[model samples]
Target: MHIAEGFLPPAHAIAWGVASAPFVVHGVRSLTREVREHPESTLLLGASGAFTFVLSALKLPSVTGSCSHPTGTGLGAILFRPPIMAVLGTITLLFQALLLAHGGLTTLGANVFSMAIVGPWAGYGVYRLLRRWDVPLMVTVFFGAFVADLSTYCVTSVQLALAFPDPGSGFLGALGKFGSIFAVTQIPLAVSEGLLTVIVMRLLVQSSRGELTRLGVLLTKSATAAAKSGAVAR
Candidate 1:
């Protein structure tokens, strides 16, 4: 979802910008380190950024100042990590704001805070938690993407509600209104994004098995066997 230009109050915009700066800065460092250490990952990283840009650009009318769309952060967050996904998501949002006018520059900070920071972190957390409990890979991936897509809208609702609370019912009422409006479109979009992410992950599993294994997205049979041998030796 994108917040149109000048939609947020000046104070709210500035507050969001200030709040989001550190995460973006840290993301920049993380992205740089990833590229430096694993130059081979550059291609996949570019693909991740492109995926976010393409999916999020398909915005549909939703809440007044915002729109609904797939976030496309979960795949990258799973393949790389949330910190790197933050950088990818920021770049995607910035381009969309400048080229497509889908979102506004003034609201970039708030947008990034939601889609880039919170969405990826929340989705990755869910994926990791589920994986630890021995959830199936594709199942975890689906939920990861689903959460990432939905969580962005949730944060956007909070931002809008805070900026323009209901006169009669206050912030809670405003939050409910915005959240309900977003959910109308966001739920299906989240499910679609989840399935799409699983498809992409399946393709990667077939074509980039080595890279996926290196990234710990998959474990090769040889690697598994080696690990078992090592454990036996120990």
Candidate 2:
């Protein structure tokens, strides 16, 4: 979700920008380290950025000065972690603001906080938890995407509510209103994104198993062999 220009009060905007600066720096460092450590990840990282750009660019009108859409940060976070997603997601948001005239430049920090930072962390957390519990691959992927998309909107709702709370009902009421508006459109979009991500992951698994294994999403040869042996013994 993109909060249009001038929607947030200057104070709120500035505060968010200040808050996001450290994360952005950390993300840049993380990405830089990734490039140096694993040059082979260059292609996958580029593809991840492109995916984020494409998915986020497709917008749907929501409440005033804002919109709902599928955030592709989850997939990247699952593959590359939230720190890397933060960098790529900010770049994607920046491009959408400048080139497509979709989001706004002034609100980039707020947008990046909600979509890039919060969304990816939430999704990646869910994914890791599920993976630890031995959830099915497809199921984990779907939930990761779904949770990431939903979490982004939730953070957006909070940001909007904080910036423009209802006078009579106050912040909680405003949050509820904004959340409701997003839920109408966002619920279905999250599910769609989840399913679509699963498909994409399946394709990647088939075409780039080596990369997936490198990313630790797929079992290595020894692990697979061990798993098969354990299954046979069981």
Candidate 3:
């Protein structure tokens, strides 16, 4: 979800910008280190950024002053980790704001905070947790992408609610209203994104197995066997 230009109060906008600055700075450092250490990953990194840009640019009209779309952050988070995804996500958002007018400059921090910082971290958390539990790789991937997509909208709703709380019912009521409006389209969109992520992962597994394995996405044969056994035992 992208909040329209100037939709948020100046105070809230500045506050969100202040809140999001550190993560973006850290992300830049992380990305630089990644590219320096593993020059081979540069191509994949660009692909990840492109994926986020293309998917997020397909904005669907949803709540007023905002729209719903696939975040396309989870795949990068899974492959490159959340820190790297943060950099890619920020770049994607910046380009979209400038070129497509999907999001606004004023709201960039808020959007990056929700989609780049929180979404990737949240999705990667789920992915790691599920992997540790010996869940099927594709299944874990699907849920990870699903969470990442949905969480962005959830955070957007929270931001909106905080900025424009209902006069009579207050922050919680406003949160409920915004959350409900977003859910009307976001839920199914999340599921679709999850499935699409799985398909892309499948392709990567076939064509770029080495890279996927290097990224720790595709387990070694021994590890896969062990994980399968662990799942069976459970």
Per-candidate alpha-carbon RMSD to the true structure: 3.2, 3.4, 3.0
Candidate 3 backbone collisions, by pair: none
Which tens-of-lDDT digit does each residue in 76-152 have in candidate 1? 99999999998899888888889888677889999999999999999999999897666899999999999999999
For candidate 3, lDDT tens digit of each residue in 55-172? Answer: 7866665545455689999999999999889889988889878888877899998998999999999999999999998789999999999999999989999999999999999999
Candidate 3 stretches with Cα past 4 Å from truth are 60-67, 222-234
Cα lDDT tens digits, model 2, 74-104, are: 8899889999999999999888888877667
Q: RMSD in angstroms, candidate 2?
A: 3.4
lDDT of 1: 0.88
* C-alpha TM-scores of all predictions: 0.91, 0.91, 0.91
Error of 2 at 176 (Å): 1.2
Better of 2 and 3 by lDDT: 3
Cα TM-score of candidate 1: 0.91
lDDT of 2 at 119: 91
